[model samples]
Target: MIDCGRAKRPGWSPSVHYAGTAIDLLVIQNLDEDHVEDLSELLRTVTVRSVFSNPTVTASALASMKPDGMRTGVSTAHNVLRDFGPGLIGRWPDTGEVQVVHFYCRFGTHFTETNDLSLATFFRWGNFTILFGGDLETAGWQMMLRNQEFQRLLVGTQVFVTSHHGRENGKCAELFQIMRPDIAVISDDAIQYGTQEKSTQWYRDKVKGIPVLGTENAYGIRDKRHVLTTRRDGTISIAVGAWGNYLVTPEKVQNELTLGEILGAFGRNALSKDSQVA
Candidate 1:
């Protein structure tokens, strides 16, 4: 998993269910408490072969240094490029099922927050590609776009997880242009950020009427297929298969019949039977 939420959320904890399983690559995009809450507990419980994080900032390192002037926690983080580059992690020989996990971690000289240090990653197999922007904002995206290598990697992205929870500051028109995504997902709570209208426009303008799906539907329904939110739909899962075929399953609603409706149905049935008999 890329990131784990803080233990504060109601009825959600990875440690309870996933602690015993082996985690091949635990990539901590940003080590800020919010991004990495309960990570220490997670590391203690789970068997992680390796962990990848951005280079430790000078300020964070200095602040964390002990009074004896010994630097600790140095062994926990490995630079992304050194650890995992653009390549295939594994493949099934018979069916040719492949796993393509790529990492793009870049930062400018003068950093302030962990968000600036987020890593951009993507997973691809067959003809489907899903891009995870890792909470990257305007400045971080601008820096990444400057690199021609990054642009080449972003083309033909089928799905895009919007950066920084679909906030306006995270909007990078160039990134959307490069990805040309069919659908975009925003991982934000309802009204936690601004209106989805702005976020929708960001990608629609670039890809020509592309749908921007948010985790929360603060605004009313625009189009059932275009603008969808998880608040109403609950959990959304997408299954991708060969030749770029994929299926998305959204939450369903159950219908219950009232007594009046049941009686009305019986009356209509009786009338139909009488007409037939006559």
Candidate 2:
């Protein structure tokens, strides 16, 4: 799981619905509260094998997981490119092997805070390259563009994860020119930390003819209806095959079953008739 969290605005832990689930690896791209809320509680529920992130101001936040029988490490720029560089990360259940290309500004760069130190990762499964920009902002993007090692990883990128929750300051038109992604995914909410109008407009004009997908509805944007939001479209899933062929689907969340409906179903069952009478 990458950046396990809900927004830090209201500051609520995730529901217990995932109590029995197991997380093999947890990738904390940024240590921002919004990206890492409920991490303590999350550790209590699921068993995480390892945690990876860039060494940054807030990288120490992951220390809690170490005592929970989990291995955690912060990657330096040289360490990333040398060790976890453009190579096989893992293979999907029924698809091609996934390769991750890592890049960070640990040496000389403009980044001094957590967001800028966020690891810029390129995940490639076959020919489908999905760039996970973390929360990298303008300066960070510029830094990556200058790094020759990072440039080598940007080849054939088609899907982009919008940096800094699609905020205006995170916009990097030059980076977009290099990637030329078909779709940009924004992990943000409708109210706080939402995608900015300027960012969306810039992408539309720069990229041209690509859908900007957001996890929540963002206000003050043109062609509002065309912008795909999770609030309306539900969870979006992209499946890629061994050959790099892909399919994108929006899994709409259905309404929860009412108590009355449950009772009606139980009553209709012959097996429950005796129990009801008893």
Candidate 3:
């Protein structure tokens, strides 16, 4: 029962997908590889029963990814069904899941459409809420906040993946206050683009005392910077770090606590007296 978690496997833990929960990503944009590299990895390994992507992937590119000539014989109109778009709904009876991934609203604007159309996703996992705000810009968050379904998915978030690598300019300050996450994961490598200071601070500060894991430092699954790895043998949680530390417990509080004054002496005294008596 992980009330909160990150991809911090010690010696060896099973893939999160095997934990009997759905995994969803809020794809914020369709640009560089850093943006989509993780996407490809997740798709390749995870048994994604269903996927929710914004109507952002270009038609040609998406078609190319499927097995050659996979979408053959389908008319362009019907192909659109096979191809997802903004405001699209698809059912997965095998998984018993319904997916609704939205794209940015387009009445006549291009600038707003791109940034605002970031894929904002919500996953229901065993009564816990997980929100993935893809490179969701400020306006996108605000707009979704007004929608009933969006608001419903956002309340009491457990794991909130920060958008755009936690950028500051995306007008995401309000997000810092609203989705007070218990634990936040920032999927950024040590690259110049994804780890910009202003961009990732919210992921650092959005939730008070939230644990933040940067990919560059954690999973050297790419660059040998992995602070830890899981064990496949025995208890399966045997993780030895480069710093000569072994992970005994997987979950640790990773945030700074800020305390505000309790103004009422009467209330404070009552709690103090109870603690002393106990």
Candidate 4:
């Protein structure tokens, strides 16, 4: 599991329960509340084998870095890391043959900002590769790009999860020069900040567009999208085959169903309930 956060919904614990699988590893990429809010609840509900995060990021360090001082989630994240310790690096058996790589800036030496200290994850399964840049800013990405190994890893990234929820601050034009992904995904809510709204086009321009299923515009025209967001698409799922071919499916698509289809489903449900009663 990566970054435990919740909004109006009940968070990810319910899904974990329903799936009936214990978390082999929980990767906390950013120390912010939105990234670590449900840490305590998750620990209580299920058994997590290990946790992967920046080792230098202590609760006190995080609190001092933030303008608002300590938050409950940050403290909880620190405690979990202390108790569980850092997860091992290498292939995880639970996740099949997928390989994982973690990247982060050193606390005082490389970055003063907490966002730069965010752990960046790289995953590879067969020819499929994806990158999750957890709130990492331009400077942080620039530093990582200097590393030859990190550069090699970015070469074949098919999907790129935008940092800082696709905020303008996280945009690193230099990084995209080397890493040309097929699609970019932003894990964000409604547009609350100007940075969130402004960077959409920039990200879209960076990636090559992918064919999206069940998505159509208001004019009833279906267009291929280069970017996808949680705010627009409820939940996005990616299934990769053995040969690295993949399919991207979104939980909700725009104009996917008409009013008549919705009403017909409701009518059918009512009839089914009536039949049960009879």
Per-candidate local distance difference test = 0.54, 0.56, 0.40, 0.75
lDDT of 1 by residue, 1-278 (tens): 76655433245556665878867766666545445555656667787665555544433342343234321222222122224432222231221464544444433354555576677777778677777777778888887887886787689676777777667877887776677766666655555555565776665555422222222266632232433345444445665644564544444321233445433433433423111000
| Candidate 2 stretches greater than 4 Å from native | 7-17, 56-96, 107-110, 193-195, 208-227, 252-278
Q: What TM-score would every model get versus the actual structure? A: 0.66, 0.66, 0.47, 0.81
Error of 3 at 245 (Å): 26
Which scores better on TM-score, 2 or 4? 4
Clash count list over all predictions: 0, 0, 14, 0
Root-mean-square deviation of Cα positions for candidate 1 versus the true structure, in angstroms: 11.6
lDDT of 2 by residue, 120-209 (tens): 877877667877778888888898899876766665765677888778888887785566655666666664544575566566554423
Estimate candidate 2's alpha-carbon lDDT, on a 0 to 1 scale.
0.56
Count residue pairs with overlapping backbones in model 3.
Answer: 14
- Which scores greater on lDDT, model 1 or model 2? 2
- For candidate 4, give the lDDT of residue 185: 95
Off by over 4 Å in 3: 1-51, 55-113, 193-195, 210-278
Q: Which candidate's TM-score is highest?
A: 4
- Model 3 lDDT at residue 59: 46
Give me the runs in candidate 1 sitting further than 4 Å from their true place: 7-10, 55-110, 195-197, 204-224, 227-232, 251-278
Output the TM-score of candidate 1: 0.66
Better of 2 and 3 by lDDT: 2
